[model samples]
Target: MSERMTTATGTRDFLLPDLGEGLSEAEIVEWRVAVGDVVTVDQTVVEVETAKAVVDVPCPYAGRVVALHGAAGEVRPVGQPLITIASLEGGGDDPHATYREEERAGSGNVLIGYGTGHGGSGRRRRRPRLALAAEPTAATADPTPAATATPTTGGATGADGGARTAPLVISPIVRRLARERGLDLAALHGTGPGGVIRRADVEAASAAPAAKLAAVPDSPAAHVGLAPAADGDVVIPLTGIRKAIADKLSRSRREIPEVTIWVDVDATGLLATRAAINAATPDAPVSILALLARICLSGLRRYPQLNAHVDTEGQRIVQSAGVHLGIAAQTDRGLVVPVLRDAQQLTTRELAATLAETTAAARAGTLPPARLTGGTFTLNNYGVFGVDGSTPIINHPEAALLGVGRIVDKPWVVDGQLAVRKVTQLSLTFDHRVCDGGVAGGFLRHVADCVEQPALLVANV
Candidate 1:
């Protein structure tokens, strides 16, 4: 045979970038392109939700997507191959191959001020070689490198005398965990990022016998959320929305210095305004969330200082010109905050329509990435859940978040007279680094004033 094509060949694997967030891993929440699909450089190939935020990962090489290494909803580790791009034409060698390599090297250069610089090595660090090869049996034993291969139902050779068993496939994260726990992959059932055996699955399988026995009535394990005679271990995987929530909250807690202020307000006028708006627009029913969103937008306009975000790069606060209000919606998957762009420009009816559309999309898991970004402020309505008050966390990249509490009849002094007025609690949490207590208090008062006297907002309109 003539010389086989080597680097001259068109196919190249695209590894998952660090996304510049300094995170070692990310969950591939969505795949925008598939195998055999034509993709251009810089085109969004996958949507990955990092611990910090949801980011659209662009393709490094422009070519036909030959294969996707992992399935969607799988968590791929950093620097691992995610996609394979093959050149459209095959020949002795492509002239632009070197340029493609350079681009691949630069693919980790994400502009979002998130991802760290790509390390020099193209391949991930290999695992240490196993020492002793332990034969697979009913007995649990540490496996050696040579003993890594387990015999399936088929023998070493098939009926036709070909190699019988397929190689075991596992994800990088699973492999790392397996190495850490000294887990024998052959013995564990995979229930993780791909069919890769996770740590929890291994632990569960190991505890299964005891769990089954404990299922009997009056077992101590059963009384304490475990199996009856045995303790049933409950395993919850950190993936998708739940994973995102954990990551975001963790980052906010670690990075930002947060302070919260609470104020009780008369919500009678706000409720009336919402009812009037809904009656006026029968096609779109206005919700208390929309009303709170409008009040936040108005408050942001009055106190523009609160409408700013801390720029980590510049080490300064950048105030936004307009308001993009994010509404925290509880979905089956988890919590999603969808933004209503230019909330300052939208009328009550328009705001209601937009909120309805976004919430529906969030619930249906069909929200576009664009609609989920660029939020200057966020509103979490604990009121719907009958919560009177809650100190909400600030959505990072935004200065503040407003929590709207349930409205209830409570006695208050109105003009020095005891009266039962419809009251609601407003909790405002801000980044102490960028916002002072006075500014936060003023912003909260402004929102409360708008809510207590809906006429004030109408006057501006």
Candidate 2:
């Protein structure tokens, strides 16, 4: 005798939510569940790497996991059904009804309620895949022992029982040489501690190929031969933050007519003011950038038009009631401009602390979505890199971006006498659509005046 079992009639599909960072897609780094694993709402089921950092994707449905559409290293488009969950027997009306019932009871998890319902029209648009072409192998490959690198404990492993090791843990300078010469990671024996790879090993391996190739003397006609056609172009697929940056920059450049104004001032008083402020408050020290940030905020307060953004769709100018100064931070990944809200209200010390916190978070790839958005103006410090002055590109949705150049000691005539003075350059790029040449010039002058005479900021405030 055989017993018949009724199959579940409905299945719930869990789609990816907009990770709250304006990211369109993410690459699946790892999966924590299998086909038969049971998952609860808000339980982390997978790890995804977005443009910013690695984020854990939580399960939106509570049931038996049916399937996973993509594997690790595959980039999944946003709003695509990633996993399917089969409703448990006696599990209420819908399989993904965890938060709905909770909401009815007036209590629910914060993020669980933000999940999208199952079985809706896919909101993600599929991007065209780029073809991966195999190039011919170069001759004179270095003869080195090929060893099966094993991953250390706590490191991620592959499915073949073979341990997965990090791609040669070497310094940046060494990595550059290894990449330029096409050296294999497994071939080089590391001289560093605990068999860890070193830069010298990579350099030695890289130099071997060049030395072998350099022996062959080139003929006079060979030098005349059509200069090795621009070492083949590389096509990089634009997605996520890079794609967004390109689109935004293009839109801003095309739509917004920009005018730039520059000014040079003696920032000696500004440095002294910062030192005094920092000396008074040991707990909260003011940075040079923070002092400039405060001056910029004060100048923006005096000239509110500088904090305005052009509304293309609305065909009008949108002015911000509050000053949200965006500090441009350069990270290994890319440039991220995190906003400091209510910049005008914060004192020099508070501004410095917030800037330090936000910039650190930005570099660590931990800046929240709210902190990265809604900036009214921007301050870009090219001076740190020894750059004298540069016309910085205006951060989109913001009317103006102020560029701060390096402060240097230069001879200047004060009261008809040549004296060494600490001078710095300031450049302001404003949207001509919202701000005219005079307004932009006035704004730059105002900022320069505040920096030149730090006491003026207090008077203006």
Candidate 3:
């Protein structure tokens, strides 16, 4: 998606390439290069936040920056002009032919499935969509009957597209915005280059409807979108991670017929096991989370059904060959599940190291996009928050999420005698379509068994 184009001039417009497949938009977190500064090919020019992680986008052209399109915190669609670079000296109108070999061959940067060629657009990029969105901000709120052009799917969603051949709509955010405002995309004229429909076009079409909503102030629908905030109400624009979390959770709840099952376990044994292992290797002491993660892998081995996701389109329950365990990390941005790939192949000590590494990276918001996705199963330790239990939502597409609650001293009857035991609650929320209560219960029970009796866990390992 990162394409650049040159005109019959000595300049190249570097468009923001597709950061990841299925991700259509990203917020400009920071810009590394300023106008007039020279930059090398593949040098990071800007950091963008796309749903899950912040990505550093590199400019593929070697030249001086001529123009910077957007600012920090601005959410822009992919393929838009990010930076305009004045090509290296003696460059003709066709920058690709005269530019360095890498410009024609590939970008040589890691941008998901891109960078192997497809660096420059090779043609003039469209007049940017952002400027259009800004120009008609006031003109879009008009209240005339002419205001309803809608951009519907076979086209965008939660991750900024993440469909309309049915039209000139490119950004899913534009499509969703059109749909929300009840505008017909076919009726509205696109002001963008080559007549592509931008978000501004949709907003312009919604002017009449917005004015109508203002007239009928009592309707619940009136308060949506650009509704005026009531006195004392704080408005937080839902974008970035918060919007992503909302869309994902809402979709998970709507599409997944999920169920929850829980059990109380004597976690005293689990703590003891960690203590003993720590005493032996104090320098590399295993964390409680790593122990739980090891046990989850064991449970997944025994009940693979819970480790699979439902391909709703194919109506198939596909089980993964290897475990890409997602650790539900609570970060300043929001809850992001940083994945530990091939967890099944790693030893408990290895898992401990990897888990610590990923969790820290997730918190710091430095993880690459690849490290933040493709999870088959998830382990959520809400226990860290000092909570006892939760019916956690299944991380969408993944069949189940295992929740571990606070381990506290609770009176229990061990060996038929009442005694205080360090106990914890374990819960599993799984996609029922993948497996019924039986598979879910088995996986949850296996985890609890490992927590209560580490001997079973040790034996398996």
Model 1: weakest 10-residue lDDT segment is: 127-136
What does candidate 1's lDDT look like per residue over 40-159, in tens digits?
A: 544557767655445556555656777787764568888888788886675246433443554545444342443222433253212111211112123223223123333343334544
Error of 2 at 224 (Å): 38
Please identify model 1 stretches exceeding 4 Å from their true place.
1-74, 77-79, 83-231, 413-419
| Highest TM-score model number | 3
Candidate 2, position 157, lDDT: 55
> How does candidate 2 score on lDDT?
0.68
lDDT of 2 by residue, 1-461 (tens): 00112255456667767776567788775576778776655455676766655565655456677788797546898878777877666645644456434323322222212333333233321211111111112222211111212223335454466765555442332333344445545556677655656666766666675544322123332222123345664344464456667887887787778878898899998989888877887688889999889888878887899898887788999899999999998864468899999898887778888999999877655555667788999999999899999987788889999999999999988889999999999999998888678778888898999888888888977
Model 3 regions more than 4 Å off: 4-6, 88-99, 105-107, 111-229
- List the candidates ranked by TM-score, beginning with the highest: 3, 2, 1
lDDT of 2 at 55: 61
Give lDDT: candidate 2, residue 395.
88
Instruction: List the candidates' TM-scores in order.
Output: 0.59, 0.71, 0.72
lDDT of 3 by residue, 328-446 (tens): 99876789999999999999999999999899777756676788889999999999999999999889889999999999999999899999999999999988888888888888888
State the displacement of the C-alpha of residue 133, model 1, in Å, after optimal TM-score superposition.
37
CA-lDDT, candidates in order: 0.66, 0.68, 0.74
